[model samples]
Target: MAFTICYAGFRSGFFTIDHIHTVKQLIEKCHEYNRPLAVTFIDYEKVFDSIEHWAVFHALYHYDLDSLVENFNDLQRTLQQLYDACMWVGLKMNMSKTKVMANIYNVTNPSATVGSEMLEIVDLKTRLYNQCVLPTMTWTLTQEAVYRMRVAQRTMERVMLGIKLIDRVTNDQIRSRTKVKDVGNRITKLNWS
Candidate 1:
């Protein structure tokens, strides 16, 4: 069974899976090492309980991991080992949906596999961020959530304009383009006099 960290139903405390939490962890570890640490965040789909316990334990014991940090070579090797472990345990990885995000000086694309398909870290993040993270963060419709959604929409609009997805952009254009409600941006009827 997955713990609170893996499943919403079991959530007990503040989630450490968020980017802010991950960034804090990275900074803390980097300070401990006394050098800037290049870090990557990997996410898997349906990761709740699909993995076999024995396989997980075996992989953990087999690998000499001092905090799951990986260099390029290590990441490749670990990817191979992960595939092998999944094969032995009858577990399948969702590579297309899996994501890897990194904050580093420079990064070459890293790769992972799912059922003979190879997926790149950067592209995986682009797809999954739009599909998963953005929606989950925006769905609550609270003041903060609504504000974030608008900010994201604006950023996306800039990207769209940069890529020539739109001829030009205006506030009206942005408002018409997205269904996201700009909840806190408007004055209420009581305040309008």
Candidate 2:
């Protein structure tokens, strides 16, 4: 089933190691199709350190683009309003390093960034990828696409562990209960229930 989490708290924020699973699934699919896949890593370090007031306010109020455009003033006014809001809240956006691009976007799959400039833009699927990569660093918010492949890998590991445990337990139970005259009969009775 598809999962949708509308709202959540800070401590239990939805970020998890789901990307690791998706990467595995993608690799498997590539092998099946005999296709090549390219992967790249990008970094945004200490972004919050340089946030100017305007950027924070812009992000806060201008969440949805189509809706925000209705109230769109010139960039100067919009940035000013954002700055005002930041002053009120003591927050800022690092203008110099705040990277915005047509194709490059923060997604849930933080590790695997997908951007095909030549390809027509498909529907964007975004998930939050927040993390405190270092103990001293602050938590950062990011969004990315869900990686199906990582999920497949995790699912496989769980299934394999379960099978192994069942086998070991079943063997032990059979050996321990060998004295029972009707072992198969007892097992059949348990199965039906």
Candidate 3:
């Protein structure tokens, strides 16, 4: 293999750690340049299982690239090889749910992003105010995504109460009836217990 994935510090076995690290590094690098970074979170179907094992790695390690065509030839060839190897072992990649999102962050102009096929560029600054910038209390917010979540919670609550949403049942009324603790309260109770 011409390219080898650095497995030196991957003992933690957590891909999210890489995600977080990537995001942090992106933030730092973009902050320096005052440029926005877009991150596409791909939904690979069982890639880790196929690539992480010693048997598959050995297969890919020996697979040589004799013929090449266009861009990303190595990636294309390697993927085909991996697919063949996995099929031989009775495993397959779900190419349908495999979303190839290029990036999510919008810096200056969302339109300025690269390789944009069908990515919807949402304003992270506005939506992430609750989780990224403000306190968790503030995350129970009346903002765009937050409002939708609260509305969903209320709708579910109303459904449980057998009440029509058009009947003008307030969220407070549903809360009073259900007496269900919110997630934060539940967490606090668990900690205390």
**Which candidate gets the maximum lDDT versus the true structure?**
1
Residue-wise C-alpha lDDT for candidate 2, range 24-63, written one tens digit per residue: 6865674466453332222233535655534543454544
Reference-based TM-score of each model: 0.40, 0.23, 0.32
lDDT of every model, 2 decimals: 0.50, 0.33, 0.46
Report the alpha-carbon TM-score of model 3 versus the true structure: 0.32
| Residue 147 miss distance in model 1 (angstroms) | 23
Deviation in angstroms for 90 in model 2? 17
Off by over 4 Å in 3: 1-19, 46-117, 130-193
Q: Which of 2 and 3 is ahead in lDDT?
A: 3
Compute the lDDT of residue 128 as modeled in candidate 1. 51
* RMSD of model 3 against the true structure: 14.3
lDDT of 1 by residue, 1-193 (tens): 2232332222466454674676687767755564423444444445566775655555545553344554655655666666666556666666656545433222444444544766554432234545654444433355565566667666664453233435556766654433233333432222321
Query: After superposition, which runs of candidate 1 have C-alpha atoms over 4 Å from their true positions?
Result: 1-23, 27-55, 63-67, 108-115, 123-193
lDDT accuracy of residue 129 in candidate 3: 38
How good is model 1 by TM-score? 0.40
